[model samples]
Target: MSRPLTATINLAALRANYLLAKRLHGGKVLAIVKANAYGHGAARCAQALAEVADGFGVAAIEEAIQLREAGIRQPILLLEGWFEASELPLIERYDLWTAMHSLSQVADIEAATLSRPLTVWAKIDSGMHRLGIAPSDFPELHARLEATGKVGKIVAMTHFARADELDCDTTPRQSACFMAAIAGLKVETSLCNSGGILAWPDLHGDWGRAGVMLYGGTAADRQLPDWPQAVMNLDSRIMAVRELSAGEPIGYGGGFVTERPTRVGVVACGYADGYPRVVPSDTPVLIDGQRGRIIGRVSMDMLTVDLTEHPHAGVGTAVRLWGEGLPAAEIAASAGTIDYELFCNVKRARFEYQG
Candidate 1:
């Protein structure tokens, strides 16, 4: 028998999440399929959302090409844009949208000969100070891209720095800075990502980038118009059952000592399977539909769970790492991380997609 470890991806939940973004943000949503749709299988997720999403956003030309090859006909935006001048023609050939984040990109566009004018997003580094033109200089940069005549439909966009903090004023200040930068321009703006869409209802734009939220991550505060369903369910199974007396220790470094007589189920998954090893004992898991907590240090290929609460669970009992009955966010929070990292780190697990 094969290892029960698998990631079940529900495409319907994914589509519904995309629609939720549209309903909440009230605009065109570029469903972020970058990072392989945050490790939920990019082609499948993109195909599921192709009919509803206004467009799709990816990290680079390579990802854009991957989507195009997978039959994604909707407009795909190269969120990070071209890495070299050589990618310009390929960007044109793929009929993909590219972001103008730096002056070198602006220069590249000016020097390159393309088959036609390109739809470019003028990225403003409002406050993130990441990969965008400075807000103070964005208006002029917008004008410069326009003057190049090779550019068309420049969408002004900025990423929020602290939008996940519901009470933080950074997002608002960043929005103000971005608006001030493009105050006189008649360009359609994209200002909201998942965090902005969830926490700042009053703030939206003509185009909103829906990222991790669409994958049913974030929302740590439960701030949403509707409860978005998690699309991926990571599951594994018990390999052995241990009957240990009090004072018995589990896994490496004797991280967790058994309190009272205990039942431990050795699961066929561990850190190498993308489960965070630092998530101290008591990280949650679902065993045979019963809630249980991980016990002790996670190993490279296995982890142990306290099955004392679950008398009926034994070898081959279904164990859910997260999704559906168990939420990944809950586990992530326990690990001092975010669900995006958890979702993207999943590897070596057989993926099964369902509608």
Candidate 2:
């Protein structure tokens, strides 16, 4: 038997999440499986969701090619589109749908001479201002792509700048801006990310891209069209348990001191294993399905959790850092970080799949 220092991935939960996202979009769902499915293993996650998802979205062309080679016949939308001119041929070969955001990418697409017409998506710079062509340039780019004869279906896409901010006005502004730019062309539209799909229902368009929400993480307050199930549980075992007297310091720099007689448990996971070191003292860790708080600085290979409240906790007890009743967002909030970073930072540890 292996130690409990492993991540358990639930494929059934992932499929349920896919269906939830699809129901919310009220159209075809383009599952965002980039960043190795947000650190849940891209290939496996994609394969698990293949029957439920209409398509897949990845940040790189290489990832799409990998899926294609694996016999995943679904359409793959390249979120970053072409990084360089040399990637054009590979994009065509894989039948990838490129999200065209810059003039150089447009030029690369026009210059490439492939056997069949390549599908191109015109990404508008709505409000993120990170990539995508300006609205003023959209019409000209659309004209050039139309003239290229090598271009196939052209969908207009934009990302919301503040869809997660429930009270922010940016989502609507970006949505209006995107709609105004594509009003004339009337091609397929994809403006909603996970946040928009859940919080701003009006922003959902012809296609919807769901990422974090499909993993049971909330981006906004709105209820999911279908309930998204938690897909991963990060757990470990208590390697050591000890009792401490009043005022005894715990871990490095004495970040935590026992206020009274206390019992503590040490888990075999730390920053090296992707558990954040910056998590404040007293951040919650789970033991025997009860909550225990970290009582000291998170060390490189272990973290100390005060089990004074749960005296029955002992060595070899399973400790869940997140998942189940403890959501990743709650842990992230205590760590002064966000859910996305925590999800993507899962280190090189063994994983057990339950779904």
Please name the candidate that would achieve the greatest lDDT relative to the true structure.
1
In candidate 1, stretches whose alpha carbon ends up further than 4 angstroms from where it belongs are none
| TM-score for each candidate, following the candidate numbering | 0.97, 0.97
RMSD of 2: 1.3
lDDT of each: 0.89, 0.86
Per candidate, the number of residue pairs that clash is 0, 1
The total of clashing pairs for model 2 equals 1
| Local accuracy of candidate 1 as per-residue lDDT tens digits, 192-284 | 999888788887988889999888887535555566688999999999999999999888999689988999999999889998988988888
**How would you encode candidate 2's per-residue C-alpha lDDT over 121-188 as one tens digit per residue?**
78999989998899888888888888889887999999987888999899999999998888778489
Poorest 10 consecutive residues of model 2 by lDDT?
221-230
